[model samples]
Target: MKRILITGANRGLGLELTRQYLERGDQVFAASRQPDAATELQELQAQYPDHLFPVTLDVTDEASINAAHAAVRAKTDGLEILINNAGIYPGASADEPTNQRLGQLTGQGAIHVMQTNALGPILVSQQFLDLLQNGVKARILSLSSGLGSLTWKSSGDPYHYSASKAALNMYMRSLAAEVGHYGIISVLVDPGWVRTGMGGSGATLPPSDSARGIIRIADQLHTEENGSFLTWQGQPVPW
Candidate 1:
């Protein structure tokens, strides 16, 4: 069984991924900012006591990421999969003026979004590099968005969210190049417009469906797929 680590495991896609991985008998390190307060995660832990490990990890905070690494290291010698799924969709609705347009975007809002969505994964990956290097056929998957695609910028709005995701894609691309020789496949995945808090209630796809598709694609990833930007269904997405 693969040893997997997923951030933002308290809800939505992260939660669904955790559940699915545990069901398949994988050892899952479910990282959340408030593990004790996560009722659903706690329930999952009860169901899969031997396979599920809830860890306290705040992606935006470096200290928390280090603490999480230490905690995971104490349990397992390595990690086969690292899902950088913790992210914030600040100003997700167009009604929020801060993310409406370039002119309306606030500096603080953009910075915060970049820190969480772009830099967080980098920091977490750095902290867990040692464990990943020791893993068998290790893979690092970052949850990106189609909005990040420069070729698909039909309507340019939500400056902070869009730009942050774009930056994340670039970072992951570079990371893939750097870590390829180590037998690690690093890539960005677009989970589609799933019905989650970030995706909004009007979204068509369900979180479980998106999670399943992503897992399937992740399972097939290898050195040849490094640096690729792909949809949940394993279709290639233009960077």
Candidate 2:
């Protein structure tokens, strides 16, 4: 069975992805910021027993990320797939009645969002580089969003979310270029507007459905696709 690691596994898409992968009999490292309070994930661990492992990971903290990486490395020599799925979108949406503008966005909120959404994945990916390199079919997947597309932003929409994702895309592209020689398949994936905490209530797709599409694309990544920005359904997303 393929071994996979995913962050933010306490809820939503990350939770669903863990369930789906575990159902397929794959080894899953389900990570969350607060594993002790993640009753659902803990229950999953109880059900899967040997198939699922629970880990505590706070991607925003450098020391925490390193510690999590070390714990995983001790248990397994390599991982078949690594999904950097933890992120945050602070404040209300731009269209909301209580929405805050760029000027009104609190310094703390903006910094937290950027650190979690952009810098977190880059540092986490770097920490696990050696583990991925040990796999025969190594793959690194960063859960980006369509809001990150520069082309879409040029059309004017979703400013804060778009800007954060765009920055994430840029970092992923650079990382892919730097690590491609290791035979690792690295790409930034836009999972579409799925129904989750971050995706909000009006989202068209369910988290399970979106995870299905994402896992499909992730499983089929090839060397030629390195540094490519792609959608859940394998479509190219302009960066």
Candidate 3:
């Protein structure tokens, strides 16, 4: 079984991905900001005591990322999959068109969102590179969004969120080139408009469906697929 590490595992898509991974008998390191308070994750830990490891990690903080890496190192010698799923999409309500618009977006809010959604994955991946190198058919999968695609940007106003995800897509593409020599496949996955805290009530896809599709795509990832942006259903998304 593969050893997988999923960030933001407390709720929504991350939690669902953790559940699906454990169900397939893979060892999972479920990292979240508040591990103890994640009731759903705790329940899963109870069910898969031998395979599920709850880890405390704040992707935006370097100290937390280092500490979480240490914790994972203590438990497993290698990690075959690292899903950088921790991210934030903050702005005005989808129904409301207030602060999130072009000129109205706050600099502070945009910076914070960029740090969490784009920079966090890069930092976390760097810390875990060694472990990933030792793994069997290692792959780094960063959760991106269709909103990030410049070609797909038709209409929407989440300025900060969209910009950050676009930046993330670029970073992962660069990382793929850097890590290709090490035989690590780096991919950016756009899990459609999944119904989560960020996706809101109007979203069409459920977390379970998105998670399942993402897992299927990740499992089939190969060197040829590296540095590509794809949907949860394995459709190629324009960069």
In model 1, the clashing pairs are none
lDDT of candidate 3 over 76-170, digit per residue (tens): 88999999999887633465434557778888878888999999999999999999999999999999999899999986687888899999999
Per-candidate TM-score against the hidden true structure:
0.96, 0.93, 0.96
| Segments of candidate 3 deviating more than 4 angstroms | 92-98
Candidate 1 residues lying further than 4 Å off, grouped into runs, are: 93-100
Model 2 lDDT tens row, 1-239: 88899999999899999999999999998888898899999899999999898888999999999999988987899998999899876543545432225446555655667788899999999999999898778888999987787676654334555667888898989999988988898899888888887788898989988899889988888899999989888999877
Query: For this target, which candidate reaches the highest lDDT against the unseen true structure?
Result: 3
RMSD of each: 1.5, 2.3, 1.7
Residues 1-239, model 1: lDDT tens digits: 99999999999999999999999999999999999999999999999999999999998999999999999999999999999999988665557445547677677878889999999999999899999999999999999999999988788686777889999998999999988989999999999998988888999999999999989977988678999999999999997
State the TM-score for model 1: 0.96
Order of candidate numbers by TM-score, starting with the best? 1, 3, 2
